[model samples]
Each structure stands twice: as C-alpha cells, then as structure tokens.
Target: MALFGIRRLLTILLIIIRFRLDQLIDVTRLPSWLCILLRFGPWRLVPAPQHNRGARLRLALEALGPVFIKFGQQLSTRRDLLPDDVADELAKLQDQVPPFSNEQARTLIESALGKPVEELFGHFETQPLASASVAQVHAATLNNGQQVVVKVIRPDIQRTIEKDIRLLYSIARLVQHYLPDGRRLRPVEVVEDYELTILDELDLQREGANTSQLRRNFADSDLLYVPEVYWDYTRRNVLVMERIEGIPVTDVAALNAQNTDMKRLAERGVEIFFTQVFRDSFFHADMHPGNIFVSRKHPERPQYIAIDCAIIGSLSDSDQYYLARNLLAIFQRNYREVAELHIECGWVPPHTRVREFESAIRSVCEPVFEKPLAEISFGQLLVYLFSTARRFEMEVQPSLVLLQKTLLNIEGLGRQLYPELNLWDTAKPFLEHWLRDRYSPQSMFKRVSHRLPGWLEQLPNLPEQLLEGPRRPIEMPVPNTDIEHLERQLQQEKRSYRWRVLGIVLIGASLMQAELAHWSPHTLALGALGLLVLALK
Candidate 1:
C-alpha cells in the first residue's frame, strides 16, 4: 500500500478505537474466538465514551473527515433505510461541517472562476452562510447589484475522498469474503453509488445544468420553486446562483408565527412529491430539511424554494409501471397481485413461490394498515415492504435508491409540518390519475403519432431490404397444429372486425340521412359510400 493509504488506515483505526465504535456491534452472537478477542484482548484497552451510540458514531465519522461526513449526510435523508436514532444524529451533518478558512475559499473560487472575488462580486461575506461536506456557501452580490450565493469546493478534499473510497473498497471485499450474507448487503455497490453522487457534486457545471433543468420543470409551478443558476459565473469548483429569501423548513415556530396553513403545506408537500415522481419522473433527490425552504410571501398558499440540485432521480418506463402497480396493490391489500407483479417484473427470482411471497407481504403490510391513514407512517410502510422483498432475494433497483431517499425526506418534512396529514389519501388520487393517463387511448395515440414520422422514414427501404435477403429453399408442407390454430384465430378476428365496422357504418349512414333528409341524393349516397369504406380499415 502507498504511504498515505497506510497512514490513512491507521488514522481511521485510531478514530474507531478512540470512539469505541466496536461497542455498537452486538458481539453476543459472534463466533467464540472473535468474541473472546474483543472481550479480553488489547481491543478492550481503550475506554468507550459515555455517550449515546448514535452520537458516538456521528462524531466518529466527523472525525474521519469530509468523505465520511458526506456519507452520514446521505444516510440522514434515508430514514426509511436506517434506524431513527442514527438517522436523527446524522441529520446534523447536513449543514454542520466546519468550514474551511475564508481566504482558502476565496482563493479556490478565484482559481476556479478565473477572476478575483472583488471584481466578480460587489460585496462578499467572509463568513460562510452554510458549510457542507463538499462545499460551503457565502452571501454575495454581483456587479449588477443582484443578490446571490457563491459556493466554493474545499481544496484538496478530493484526494482525501479518493483515498477513503479505496479503503472502503478493501473493506467491502473483506466482508464479501468472510460474511455469508455480505453479498446481499451489497456494500461495495452502495459505496460505488455514493462515490458517483459525491463526485458529481464536485462539478459545479453539472450542478448548474441540474438546477437549470429543475427550474424549467417547475417554471410555471406554484407548489415548488427552483433557484436560477448563473451559468456565466459557474465553473467546475465554484457555483453562483440567485439567492432566495424564505424560512427554513425546520423552523416550526417561525412558520406558525407566519400563520402558514400547516395542513395545506403538508398536503402540498406530498402532492409535489407524487408530481415529481410520477408526472415528471424527475426529482430533486437531495431534499433534506437543510436544502429546503418555504417562501414567506403567501401564508395561505405556501411555496417551497429548493436549493442544492446536485442529485436527481428518474425512472424507466417499466420501473414506473411496476412501481405504480406495486403501490396500488399494497394500497388495495392485494398481496397475491403484489407477489405476482414482483415476479412478473423480474424483481425476484422467477422460481419464487407466489404463495410464500404473498404471505410474507401480507404479514408486513397488514399491521401498517391497522393504523389510520393519517397516523400511519409512509416511510415505515415502504421500509417494511422493501424489507419483505429482501427475504425473497429480490435484487434492489439501484436507480430507485435516490427516489426512496427523497421519499423518506419528504415524508419526514411533511409529518413535521402537520402531524395530521394523510399522505396516503393526498397521494392516492394523483397516482390513480397518472396511471389512467398512462394507459389511456389518447396517450397511445400520442405515442403512435410521435413514432409515425420515424416509421415513415424507414418505410421506403423496408420492402427492398426484405427482398434483398437470400430466398429460402422450397420445402414440403408439414402439418403444424400451432400454425393452423393461429391462422384460424387471425381469420376469425379479421372477420369479426370487418362485420363490426360494417355495422357501425350502416348505423352512421342512417343517422346522417335522418339529419339531412332533404339533402341531395348524391351527397347522401357519397356519405354512405364513405361510411362503407371504413370497413376496409
């Protein structure tokens, strides 16, 4: 190993020992040899801190530095996938990371943007408004006198992250080799996903593009607002964007003082979530409390102003359909359909028994349904459903992880806004409408119309291409029951449709003559003839 890697490993080991993180693990069920070592060997020499397990874990990660701090920040949003205590503690990491010096921030910004801070901004605050694992933000004004926020990436943090990621990969391989269920946990894959997300966040231009796309998605929306990205001032390591004035989503007292309609706000939060997930299929994935704010202009009709658009989620068509069906099935308490849908969608092994999976789903969902929709927890229910799938060895959909995290965050924020909010009822109607529109005839017609031009472009060469292929040798006729049956079925369907169209034309002809009995015979005859032509279709 390289010297830095070896030193970094030592530092991590020291932090782990100093914080006594091993105490967080339950060693009672471990193998005898390991248990004895942990209990009696030098490992026990270090005294554990007298703090809550969650607090100690958080402090340990913070001590490890920014890369681990970013992991904790991400974990904080995924309350559904984590224990409440740990997630609650990790939530502090979202905006609580200690900031780098202002001089360093200014130097990094100047180097990245190719301009001095003074020339670019009329005034810049030396103290950071917010400090995150990857970057910190400062209040600033453009030369045009417009208020904005300047975000600067930490200098030399990327090297630390890369080194830590290598260490994580090594640990993942060790776990996969030594632990029986380590593959199921997919620790390596999870860390890789985090690596990509955090690395993407380092690119301010990418974030600028994400911000612009989100702003366009909700350009006319009142429920949510996205800040405009100042592209001219954005670069790989520095970002400038329009500053928003609003109350932080976490400040319950301030919102109450503003006379905000808490119920409407909470319900709107759910609506916005469904709209993003179903209607647009694109969502702001990093929606922690720190990244969200509520506009104070309208107390009666609250609007959300979101910042930090580094992570986004989108669903494929198959995923969208299956996920919707699964949610609807869960809502309806149709465990059998849920199980069948999982198999049909290839979420679980094809050979998995439907009855077994159905029973498991029933057990997981039944208790959740016992509570009133207003009192039930969306995150908990989803977590239970996902947990049930794990028993069937269902492969997790990597892309939807972001959506799941965002849902957990939204659920948390909604419940905080209004305890009585019925997320189920608020979101059910929207989902039903989206599904209806997805399968409607008008929707089909729109899709067909979109592809018709492409089909037309390919039409002229299709006949030539088919004829260019080598002709098959003549063969003796063979009796095939399957082909005969299929031919008969197609003929029957064609005859039926032909008669059906004829009947419809005859009825239309009679109505037309009745409406214009005094019209010319030739015009009426032509109309009847045109109606008859529909049978050919």
Candidate 2:
C-alpha cells in the first residue's frame, strides 16, 4: 500500500511537471536548466495546457488522498507560503471533501453508545449540517423537545489520514533532497504538526472536553456562549451538544434586524480575541463564519456563540505574558522595547541587531500612527512584523499562524459588520487592563494566596531534595560506568534548557525592536531566571 501510494504520487508529480507547475513555483533558487528539466522531464505525462491551476492543484491533492487534502488545508492558512491568488483559491477547500455515508455515522454513534438510534434522539437528520475532512455534524433534537446537534467522525478517517501522512513523509523527504526551499519550509515537520491536529480532531471526546472547559471559561460572561456538551451521549467518535440559535456573525443584515450595536459588536470581537489569547491563553483557533453565530437575545449587546471546539490554541505561559506586553508596547509606540522583547522571547536571534530591527519596525509602524485609533490595523501590523522578522531567519510558528489566521477572520467579519471600526482602540483597553491586573501587587498576592496550599505542602520536601541531591548507594556501579551515562543525560537536558533560554532572549529583543521598550525589564528578569535554571542544573 505504501509503495502504491508513492507510485500514484510520482504519477501526479509527472503530470504536474508536464503542466509546468515546476516553473509556476518560484525557480530563482534552482538552476535554470534543472528547473527546465523539472518542468519537462522524461516523465511526459501530458503536454502543458492552460487550466485553472489553483483548482487543478486542489483536485490533484484530493486525488492524492486525505493527507494531501489536510496538507492543503494548512497551507491555505499560510498566505506567506503561496501566491495570494493560489492561497485565496485554496481557502475554499475547507471541509468540502467527500464525506462518508450516513450509515457509517449511524453505525459509529450506535457502537460508541452501545444503543439504538431511537433511544438517543427524537430525530437524526440523514443530511449533514456541514461536513469537513474529519467529521460531519447533523441537526437533531431530544425526546424532551430540546434542540441538539450531533457530530460524528468520518469512518476510516484515521486510516486514511495515517496512510496519507506516511505518503507525505515520503514526499517531504524527496522535496528536501531536491528542492532548495524544502529545508526552510520544513515540510516533514509541518506534516507532523498537521497529523497531531487531525488526530486530535478525530477524537470527539477531546473536542467535548475542550468545549466544556471553554464553556466554563465564559459561563458568567455574556460575551460568548459555548453549548453544553452532553457527556452522557458523547463518545470517542460521536458528540452531542445543545443546539444554539443565533444570527451568523457574518450576516450583517440579520444582526441589523436585531438592532445589534455594530460598533460595540466589532469592539467586543477584538476584546474576545485578546482575552482568549492573553488572559486565558486558550482560544478557538477556527473562528470562521460557519463556526460562529451572534446571539439575537441581546440585540444592543450582541454576544457570540462559538462551536466546533476541535481546533484550539494555547501559548506558552511566557508567550502569554510577553504577548500582552507587546500589544501594550505597540499601542505606546515603544519600538525599542518591542525589539528587546522579541529578542528576550526568542522570536528572533539573541544576536539580532536591535537598532536595525527597531528602525525597521518604526518604518513599518510610523505611517499608521497618526490615523484614528479605530482605523489602525492589527493584522497589517502583524504582517509587517512577520515580514521584518523574515530577514532575521525567524522560523514560522504553526500555532501562531493559526492565531494570526483566526484574528484576520474575526477582524474581517467585524469590519464587514461595522465600518469605521478602530480595532486598536477597542483592544487597547482590554490588553492594558489585563496587563495591569497581571502584574499588579494585588494580583501577585492573590497568586501567592492561591498557591499557598501547594507551596506549604512542598515546603518540607524542598529541604530534602536540595540537601540530598544525589548519594552513592552501598552497591552502586563503579564511577566510570554509571557516572558517564548520568552525565550525558544531564548534559542533554542542559542543552535543551540553553536553547529555550536563548529563544526567550531573542524574542524579548525582537519585541523591543518593534517599539516595546517597557518589555526590556521583564526580558532582563526572565534572562536572569533562565540563567538561574541553568545554574541549578
């Protein structure tokens, strides 16, 4: 099967070359003659012909099977990876792939619950409300007259994904060997990340847990609503959750009908994003229109209803803190601090030129500074930052890319609903207040108080671990044998910590360069902390 998959891939590659896709991709990095050979090689599958290249590419990926479809889905998020036209076309490929039969869905749900369909719900629609590469959702209702929705994983999607993933690995190996940009793109690594995400999405149980947690996060707030996950009816392949009725966030006319405060709605969108990113660090990574709805109950104070919790994101604790700091710095036009923070956070190299980065940031940000706060574009700022960091060899962060994409989608939707939306102004207060509370003395006291029990419990063990770090037992191996092995392990662990510290420093510097000088103190403090961690080792 593996051999056959590769054979089919080779055939597809032959066709692509025959059609001059090799030339379509940037060839400046490859030798001219080699590029020509790649386009018109001995694998003469077909003569070059005019076609909608983007659609052809999508179709070819589908032919190659689920792995490539998944790959294309991810690549769609990376506007930086492909030409705008291609990326725009690819974005339409979301969850529109062929779906498994309704029979399979019924079978899987029944198997998961160990019961008949009649016992589960009053009605189960044969047609899916929506179908994606991994699963399908159907509208349903309970016997007690409560509306609900059923989500079931596509049958054999796991096998399909696994098979395609192996093929992708093979393709990545070949590309890395032959293509100049392969190493930089890190295709294999990207595939690995996608594999993890796709597999996690297949597990409805995990999705349920994510929804439940997020629901809890916003339980008291009327800003966003997550449906209750009916655990009693949930299983690995199937999930049942409360049905929500609201205007799609993208439906401007409907929102207007409900007298929604468009300005407030737009502002709240920005606040929700920043809050999830900074305060909670867990955000709905997929905030596309199909997965979001606006509550009609509070027309003047519209709230968002979010579903499809399969894709989510979280930052490292330090990232959460520094991101908040960076946002605050950007608003204050603290470019030097931004640069320094970037370096400290390891978003750039520790040795990156701070002055140059700061100057570059100023050039990008200065033009938009005097504009009305509502007119400022956060997405544009991020693009500028990313473009600037490209010079310093900043590797693309997959998780950050997801966040960037989601933010863009949300911002676009908000602007559509309400023109003259000043995203920066709306977000500035939330970010500012979040940071203030985060670093405030009272907040520190609260944190200490919250952890007091755990700290007290560990107090007695601290002395023992520190004083008795390591001891030679009576029957210990000779020093040369075990000591060398132990030393090697410790050295490896130390190296890992060293790289992590270096990364932090680099990010801090980058942030400072981007006009966030206030972050310098925190960066320095973290550097000291990182050094302490190294010393302890």
TM-score of 2: 0.80
Query: Each candidate's lDDT (Cα)?
Result: 0.80, 0.76
- Put down candidate 1 lDDT per residue, 1-537, tens digits, no spaces: 499898988998889899987776556756778667767867688888988988998999889877888876765655434577987798776446788999999898888778888999999999999887788999999999999999998888788788888998887685555454556556677677778888998898989998998899889889999998998889999999999999999999999999999999998888888888887888889888878999998889999999999998888878888888888888999999999999999989999999999999999889889988788877677777776787888766656677777887898789989987888888788878888998764464344346445545655665554344323343666467666775676666665555544444443444445456744655445445544554454
TM-score of each: 0.84, 0.80
Candidate 2 per-residue lDDT, tens place, 376-467, comes to 76775676677677677777577777777788778887888888887877777887788788866446434534544554465466555444
TM-score of structure candidate 1: 0.84
Q: Can you tell me which runs of candidate 1 are displaced by over 4 Å?
A: 26-36, 76-95, 179-181, 465-537
